[model samples]
Target chain A: MQPFLPVYAPLSDQQIKHIEDMADQVLAEVGVILQDDPISHEAMAAVGARIESDKVFTKGDDLRALIAQAPRQFTWYGQSPECDVVIGEKPLYAPTYGPPVVETHDENRHQATMADYEALVLLCDRSELLGTTGSLLTIPHDVPEEARPIAMARAHLEHSKKPMCGSIISEQALRDVAHEVGTDPSKCHLMHMINTTPPLVIQPNPLRCLRAAVELGQGNMVASYMMMGATAPVSIMGALAQGLAEIMVGLALTQIYRPGAPVVGGLFATPFEMQQMGPMFGSPQSQLVQIAGAQLVRRLGVPCRGDGMLSSSKLNDAQAGYEGAITLAASQLCQADFILHSIGWSEFGRSYNFDKCLADEALILSSI
Target chain B: MQPFLPVYAPLSDQQIKHIEDMADQVLAEVGVILQDDPISHEAMAAVGARIESDKVFTKGDDLRALIAQAPRQFTWYGQSPECDVVIGEKPLYAPTYGPPVVETHDENRHQATMADYEALVLLCDRSELLGTTGSLLTIPHDVPEEARPIAMARAHLEHSKKPMCGSIISEQALRDVAHEVGTDPSKCHLMHMINTTPPLVIQPNPLRCLRAAVELGQGNMVASYMMMGATAPVSIMGALAQGLAEIMVGLALTQIYRPGAPVVGGLFATPFEMQQMGPMFGSPQSQLVQIAGAQLVRRLGVPCRGDGMLSSSKLNDAQAGYEGAITLAASQLCQADFILHSIGWSEFGRSYNFDKCLADEALILSSI
Candidate 1:
């Protein structure tokens, strides 16, 4: 089937150009902080990037050239050939990831266990709408920190045949998941999500994971998870510029590490709520950011990644439905390539509800 | 603001042309039953319509000529100047109309009284999103049948500064409401909804109301309320053809009654659920119909009318939110000019929930 075209563009071409120029300026002048990662600093210095202590600066032309080397589209292979997905051709859906709690009708709230993780993987496998099983639909609290990645990967391998993500917490965790799944990273069976800290900073662990993934030739979804009005600029264009700068740095690094590496660029941010003293999700501002981000990614000739069916509501009530529907619809209309958190997300990604997950799957199919 | 362009088009020009041609054939060959109304029968005969008892037939060219006489767009004056709205330029929202029951947080459901009607009118008046204080948001059972129109009109006139609708049960009711509101028919303040009984029949009361509205130079929303697979054809295109034929007949009658009258066209229908033995609302099929209907209305060079925030769920729960959001988004994207049942519809329009009404209003404002 042909890919769905964007029905709405939140930013005009002139506005997109202005934001792109600003992003380039931020990359060249302000630079990005490579926090506690001397390896990244050395790598940047070797690639003609200027290194001044922790800050690494690169010109817009250099970043663009590196970005141009990355593949515009790539296929992520699943265990079954029928489950493989072409990343840049259409909007692919994945389940909500990294939630720490699970909510069911019997239990109001409980720490997610390995059993819950396996069940969720099974659900994703059975769902016609979900394209990927997703990594960490909820954190398995019963599993020890050292062995969690292996256990999660085993659950995914055993219960689902869909393409799934490898752990990004550490280099070892990423390797463990790939080895357990019998995935050849050179062919890129598993993808990894590397999130940058706000205000143009890449932490040591995430940077390490990025290097490991690139060296192994695994796909990467590089993103900046910033909170506007707090860690990033409050304005939409400003925040977009900052986000673009961060993601571009990460993406450019992937190309430098291994040219023609498969990577999806992401821009995910939320406006900070002063009263709650936290970030809000499924908001109109965030939705606009997602739409504008898609436009930017399209301009860069890379696949765009963002969340779908995201909500801050605690229960699967009207608020959850409205918020989820709005965000999901926005993602579809914006022509996002890969939609994360496509189902079972609640309470700012803290809790995953089973009934809501089922309902959201139906919603996704209806939309298609 | 400029009108919203369609985000989705369910029918292509070729398909629409085919449907229109089929509709013309239906009108000229099959004819329509003008039920139990001698006045309408005589009027149809006078206008070169072939009448045999109750069946009134006319060729496509005559109907087209009559339809061409009606204005493309007109202003609907509200009590306050700021509240006055241009009918065809953009989507105009109106509250839910003609529900006999009301639901609240404390009560499951109860018979609606005059108090409920007045409160709803007041709510619509205060709502920033609602464009019109819709007629009979809930049936005022306390009001006697003969005085219902006067009571409903008074509630709207006294509580709201927005545009509203008049009664459509009888010609007397239409004139009574107009006289009570002191509206000049030439510049219609109150619009009337005239529903045609499918397949291809206009009952006596609605025909009488239509004639009265047209003769007085008032605006009329002529529609075919069809139940697909039951009262109309099962196929979407076939149902659309039948609906178009019915509505065009009413539109022609309005033009024949008084040329250059303000009018809006509507195509409202739902697919029948065989097991449930009822029509389902807020379904994906209905949303598609609405989008295709908007394209049809646009081609006719007239404003389109439909519903918003419609749901089949009994409770204002996740189902309600999802269904309502899908339909509402579809209506907005389709560029419906007059969105009736804009808020607080539930159980397929059998009951109106107060909480849902408020939430739906907020949803509407957020979209803008």
Candidate 2:
């Protein structure tokens, strides 16, 4: 991993001040509503917030200000002069592999392997992408459960020069990976997802993952994916606000544990088919709401992340292109600071279709 | 506008070296065909290239390697937290406005003004945009021609904290406004439009303006805006590639003068109206071609720029939204690093429509 990552649209001194004030107001008055996770709830309470079941409230102005202190733009190193890319201050393009990793040199979804990781690097290098995800799209097969994080980090450091972000299954994994990446446990930017359980509640594992990522000094790209009319409110905006609340509460918790902690807020919401019980992408409204969520996060003056080449109907066909284009277009228009799943993505984050990834890279590159 | 604003994709060190070698081969064997203006021809001749009329043929590899040297990203300054945005490395959002000079303000069709600029700042702040163009559509009544650039730059600097791209009009206007805003000329990202002069020709003034901007050390964002079937080839891709070629020649000239200059290559091609003898933005092919052009530019590896809220219809209505969304969506999806006519734009960059700009911002923000 590179020693540093680049940032864009830096905040002014006044903006920083405003964010601090807002954070305090949110912490003191608004407070956060955590799910039914007593451990996280206790952690929030320990950090000077009042706890009421899953709800945690306190003044977090200082925390907001500190996180807001994260520079708007900075340099993230690449392999050399040619590979170096500035992310925030400029538009950076990265291609991603879709879900259900394909075995290297074969057709079949399986756990990711080192060869898959290497293929990703070569593809990213060959394509127009400024970076690669190391072992993107959930490389479950490559490493043992206990050693996954460290293995992934080492792969990135050894195989690629561009910046990469992803999750570690556990705290030990996070620590091991942090050591391998040489990032301060508290300042790393690892990706994680947060979803509502039945009836709009965050699950324990993801909840703990969110807090742990932040507490350890690694930035959390907290994704709040709400399926409208299922685990979330029926309306897209309603679902968006709810998702925002979940991520914000988690982010607020991290900032409290350690002020000035780096964190990125994100949303991965879409529509759900009641009859089929399937998630739907390509809904214009779904994309709209996701973009709106991105704006809402940015409004809070924090870096926001989003996916671009997202598709629900697993095939890498016209549906993928149309949905991916719409999704990528919406987020880019909304000026998402960081984009995950920008390329080689399809089938609801399953199946890394090479052609689709290449096409998506073209789309992502065009947007920047 | 350094001597050369080479458009290039991010390449591995080996690839860069390979391209450099290729460039050397081209420089010594196959060469570039420099067509158009005599000044450029003369400039190439001085560089030891063969000239035919306005055409200059050079060894291809030298130019290729020179272009490969361009930095993948650079910093752009913003006025406030709301407006702070970047281009080059990542896609940045900017707003469009109605043309105040030609249009009147109303509930639906609002004219642009200083107040409109202020409103734009608020909306831009609320939304996720990288930078802004003052008067989004065009506040002709708000500021005199002499003062337009200053007013726009000043508003962006004062109201928002985002990096801004320089305005169009005249070279002197650019310098004057840069002075007014106390911006260093070297850091400015200047913009201009190139219209096809029917069949195959280039106008002198806009060309001069582009060259002047480049000479001043300001970044150039050039667009070839064609009204298809009338001003350009009927096929959208044909028009797109031709338009890209037109700009590339000019861009190549910039590089010849200054190596590794910051430049954005862009295309804005729309279908033409036979009866009205103008252009229409409602066509979907224009949007698709725009997306394709973005791919081409990134394939070439220079920063890509284009428009969003552009329309040729004289009014702001559903046609506007549909067309604007399509175009803007393409722009964002293509990951255009810098976007002009992104907000408050209407009638194909002819007037200021604040309401339309506002709606575009809202829609774009909420877009997926």
Candidate 3:
């Protein structure tokens, strides 16, 4: 993969600095609400953070300093030698990470079964564009809830030799996947996705996932799916500040757990359509926040994870095409290091269509 | 309308200079073939350009000198006062200029009727994005070939008060439309599109159309639709040079016929796919040529006409969406002033769909 060169940055350096300063202020004043996580609170306290009840406050410098200890780039290994992937070299594409439903070309959506999950794995394996058979292609309704994580990992191991994301469901579940795959901890075999709750908060489950993955010398991705005017602020600047502050807190956790942990920062913002009461992707404001915020993420000296080929359209029609194309182009414009959900995402990431996946990857192939 | 600022220029100053040098060399050496056009030959000789049979040769400096007299920007007046469009200020969108086939949302294609042509006129009038009524939305199969151009112009005048393209089929047809609409030439009420046959040639018919429009103080657009590796040189630099030279010869004619005439330069190049034996849109090479070539056209001191929302896809699917979005984004990136074929174009500009038009425009809305 050739290195991505940013060509469509809309914000000035002064504007970026202004947003960064706001993020710093948010971290210093409002603080992140840590939910009943003593280990996280203790880690923050050890790093000289101010804590009250469930709120943990740290200066931006403290967070940045902790984040600085994390490696800016690293390599992830698969069972196969050719499957090794360099995280920050260029735009690395992965399939849809989370979707509960599958939409076919004929326009029928159904609960994604285990077969559908395995099919996506094979599709990614066959694709020339995608590197990893992404983690959590969809939730498998067929698998028993308790045994699902391990079964998913087993599918990854048996189906293909490509790198996959370990389950962040539980510390034990993730540990079992590592053992099942027999992957070396020294070679960062997995990138555990840890989603953050917005408005300056991180759940304890994801916190535990981050710590477990970091301690094992694996990659941990901190991401927030924000809907402006809803979960996030209406203004791009306000949303960016909150988004940046949220991600920084999560990044700080990786270094606090273990220095030099491989980590990626993702802040995906889509404007909330007031009339529809849902997220709207591929808007100009969405593009602005993505390009500007990714620049902010890079300032912290780490790889920024990008969301790609996302659309609210149910069918793989023109709406899906434009939305996917526009969003994907924003990733390239900002030169986002690791692109997640690069293909096969539709209905606002609710349903994955096989045809849309092929069509989107073709678009990506044409663009870059 | 907001003035567009170019943001995605990929060519370096040296590279632009190299292409310019190549264009200059081509014009001085190969020359443009002006077939059976005695008046054009006389105009070229008057400008001290060398002429041999149908070939007209002039130095790049000589061509640039003549082209410098054309207006860089102008106000095009519609019948309604609110419909005034300032060319070169921002992107002024228009509908599909030419397509003989019409495809509907139900996935059916048929020969375009007079009803389809008029429907497109009304669509453009209803559109908030599109400024002009556009030239030829589609060829009317019901209308006689000889009377089609005047019939199209009449539909634009009768349906909407928007500024529209004058008939360029002949010198008399254009004059008839100006008189029928009762439009004053001083206000630049029309922009006539005159297509250039590729491989450095402009047929006499279009030359006559260009001359008639320029004589009446109306705008003239000299555009070439070239397929690289077939009608044009395989290399982007080589294609760009040939494109610029072809356009310069036409732009120079506008000055020789009537100095300070408003003109636009369009050089649309799509790569020729070997297996398909047709032009492919949305390719990275297509974007580079569009952006770099538009910059070269801007250097000639006229508004660069852009072809937008173009695709070779047969359906209003993801392929169409990506291709249209990518191409439209290129126009915005290069800040092309007058955007033609901005919506409803499909199947390599041979088919137009109502659903695709609305969908493409929505994509543009989400983008800018």
Best candidate according to DockQ = 3
Clashes by residue pair, model 3: none
Better of 2 and 3 by TM-score: 3
Q: What lDDT score is found at residue B105 in candidate 1?
A: 66
Q: Global lDDT for candidate 1?
A: 0.84
Ranking by TM-score: 3, 1, 2
The residue-by-residue lDDT of candidate 2 on A127-216, one tens digit each, is: 656454534444647566566566666666676666655454665656566556666553344444434343334566777776666666
Candidate 3, residues B249-348, lDDT tens digits: the string is 9999999988888999988888999998988986766777778878888889999888789887887777788777778877887888998889998887
Sort the predicted structures by DockQ, highest score first.
Answer: 3, 1, 2
**Candidate 3: which stretches are off by over 4 Å?**
A1-6, A103-109, B1-6, B103-109
Tens-place lDDT per residue, model 3, A168-247, is 88999988887887767688999999888987889989988898888787888898778899999998889999989998
Best-matching candidate per TM-score: 3
Report, for every candidate in turn, its global Cα lDDT versus the true structure.
0.84, 0.58, 0.84
- Candidate 1, which segments miss by more than 4 Å at Cα? A1-12, A38-51, A59-62, B1-69, B233-235
For model 3 the local lDDT of residue B100 reads 87
Q: What value does the lDDT take at residue A25 in candidate 2?
A: 52
